[model samples]
Target chain A: MLDVEGLAKATGAGGKEKIKIQRQITLPWVEAVRISVRNVTIRLGRTMITASGIVLGIAFLSSVWTSGVIQDGLQQARFEQERELVAATTRDQAKPDGGKTEDSAAVPGEEKQAQNSKRIWLVVMSLLVCGVGITNAMLMSVTERFREIGTMKCLGALDSFIVRLFLIEAIALGVLGSVLGTLLGHLAMLGIFALRERSLSVAAKMDWGQMLTYLLLCILIGTVLSLVSAIAPAVRAARMRPAVALQTEI
Target chain B: MAKIECPECGEQIETTGIVTVCPKCGADLREVMEAVGHERDERMKTIVRDDSVTTHEFIVRTRDLKKIYVMGEIEVPALRDVDLDVRRGEYLSIMGPSGSGKSTLFNMIGGLDKPTAGRCFIEEVDMAQLDAFELAWLRCRKIGYIFQTFNLIPVMTAMENITLPMIFAGMSTDEMMDRGRELLDMVGLGDRLDHKPYELSGGQQQRVAVARALANSPAIVLADEPTGNLDLHTGKEIIDLLKELNQASGVTVISATHDLKMIDVSDRVVHIRDGEIERIEHRADIDLEVGGMGEE
Candidate 1:
């Protein structure tokens, strides 16, 4: 860390007092974010296209989970009805077989469990594909903006700042797209189940709190997936040499 | 330019070079010319202060600078042992054909690239000694760059482009706006600040780039073929604008260019060829003026 005055003096400059030098200076974080926000908005078409991958991934994932919840609610409703009828018809017969209370909460057979796992596996594969899509989109974005990144670097933007710009973009898009996808998926699942069952009784049986938790989880997964996928492209953009900006110019 | 006078008759004589005898008075003038004519001023003196170069001495000094790129075990020497000195307020031009390493040397001087061997001192600070952040700091305040392609951010308005560097310098919004306006006005784009780069023509965009370069009042400006893409008339206009800016602010300008019109405004032109300094020509020694070279 050679101070400007010390450096000038050591180098024998007679005009040492004319300039001041500091070792580190960076664009304030708020300013960097502001610039990034404006950049995303200015290129909203590409942003939306990139974000659609996250939206679709989270949509499919939440749809499957929500459909399972709705099916469980419907099954529990039917089970309760059958148990009530059995108890009423045989009130005094060995205290209604003495085991229905414990059996009411028991999970379904292994066949259902196996089916559930298969559905979950399909959703997970789709999300992985979505992650790859986001990565490819981000890589394209980085290459397209190579000249801009170079200009920014030459204007004193640090490599970290460059990485920060991409991450901020990912977060904003991920959060928004994921939230929309979750709501859309849950409602679509609910609507289809309602049409098939021709009844609103399943809605009453559902624990809204549990459904909300899964929705939030799906949203979180979508956002995290985007960020993870963005890291490689963001790092690549940051590691770019500023000279490439000039050399790549048309 | 000393006018020698005959001591006996007090008659003035044109005694440049070896005019030993006065034409009118028939008296020897060698003694008088020797006393006043042979004195060297700061510009002409070859003064070396120890082994170090100071800013007041030369704003940019490179010693035995070298850069070699390795492309899968193939060693490509871009620049080799290039010793160059740029004076304060001097307009220096670097000329070489494609693949001649002229741009490589320019990048090294601008601190945009590092030399593999030896040192490049800018404002008396060795470029290799500065960390990335500090090197950026130096570039922000000390070196301004104008590209041949006029690399203004496409998304930003001309005003924003000018203020971009000021933002990195940590100037307040108000100060940035004030200085941005002043710089845009200096480049004759005061009325076009709101226009984006795409909205303007090639020359206009380059003008905005010039304003952006000057936003920080940097001590040196590095222009790489600034007028290479413009028409002959527009290119000359750009050159004149740079020359005027150079004369007005006394900012050292070093350009890598093939445009001969650039030579008209340059104080010195450095010719690089095959990773070495082929020759250096001062403005005084260049016979070509504006249009073409030689036999004129």
Candidate 2:
């Protein structure tokens, strides 16, 4: 009731004088929102560079999975060939035995070894490609933010805030790069499959579990590596004195 | 009020309320006013504390400090052992040459950098003992700073830059906007609140920086070469605004600058050289009229 009376008086006075006193403490937040948005904006392009590594990892992972599918098809084809040969020989020799030797050769050990080697090569190569690229990208990002990191420390920003900022940037990069790389890798796999068999949609047989695992692993690796790489620089920056940073010519 | 001869005409002039520069020739003010000596007795009357004291008194104090930088095996000492005290509502300036450690001293006082060895008391609490979060809280709650180059975030508008610290302080959006606008008006930049730093002149940019510094009503305003980037005329304008902030709001002002203009208004000047205090001079004790008149 007091507030309403004050409001009425304020209206008569023709200004903002009649609002509740609590309104003085509460202000419009648009400026804060705008500032936060700007901070995110200034960092977006640089953050994209950090994410590039994630994209590479995703692309390699998708291609390797697609290749594994092709290898499966090859195994099936070899089985079919062995079955046909066995049938022809058995038919010609007039000996159709009930023993179930359908298609495999007398020695299965060598065949199994060869298949294992191929799968091992694919998985090893994929891990190597992802790890090396992600590490390199992280190193570059840490170096680029050297001065800015120093400035923030001098301004009284805590080490935790520095760590959180870099990690968030890395995550954003990872998500964007992974999604785009997945789409591109899927499309490329389809093209390759069509080249071999016009009616085959081999790329459409995406193993969601496998893809999700690969993406999660790659992002986790990237984020961890980035945080690790940022540790040294962040410390250096946090311990930096404002006087020294301002005096720095760079 | 002390009396001193004018450096230009050798005419005796009253030291009290006398402009440092000669009325007739406008000679170098520091020299003209040197004869009066630092009137330490007069400093007692200028105290301007108000009702805003909260949680503490005497936000920052420094004693016998030094900072030495070791670069590739060379030990370069910056700040000398210096003792100073900044209470609420006082505006002080630190002036010296390029190699002089004014900037370093200011940085340590503001808790932006730690001194190599010495005691610094901020808000009656030992600065060296504060943890990282505690230091951050102190900076957020009790201190505001302006830099010479107008370190406004490039991508943000005048309003956003002013409100940047408030965001870190976890102020609500409404509060930040209201505070930001109030600051802009205080600095006479309300009309340019939406403009980016690039669009503003050097003076305007400095004004924006001042508004940003006051966003949280920090007890101390530490400015390092705040007017160093502006032209002479613009520099004078900035000085005027800083004076206003000191007089009107009672915000303690500490500036590190080579600009001689600061000597006129600063309450005290501590000369540092080779990482040591060569001399500590008060403004009132200078013999202002002892030089240049006879030579002329």
DockQ of each: 0.22, 0.09
Query: Candidate 1: DockQ?
Result: 0.22
| Candidate 1, A1-250: lDDT as tens digits | 1245544453554433344456465678787778878877887887778777777878888888888788778776777787787777667565656566555545454546886798789777867766776677667777788888888778777788788888887777778778988988888999898889887766787778888898999888888887777888788877777785656643
Q: Tell the DockQ for candidate 2.
A: 0.09
CAPRI-style class, candidate 2:
incorrect
Mind giving the per-residue lDDT tens digits that candidate 2 earns over B1-296? 23567767777764433367667676655764543333322221122223243433344566667777789999888876776665556667777787788878877888877888876765555667666676776665566778887777676788877776676677877988987886786566768889989999998899898877777676678898998999887787777667766766677788888888777666556666665667766655553643421311
Off by over 4 Å in 1: A1-20, A91-112, A198-205, A245-250, B1-55, B287-296
Write down the worst ten-residue block by lDDT for model 1 chain B.
B42-51
State how far residue A107 of model 1 sits from its true place (Å).
7.6
When summed lDDT is taken over every stretch of 10 residues in candidate 2 chain A, the lowest stretch is A18-27
Quick one: best lDDT, which candidate? 1
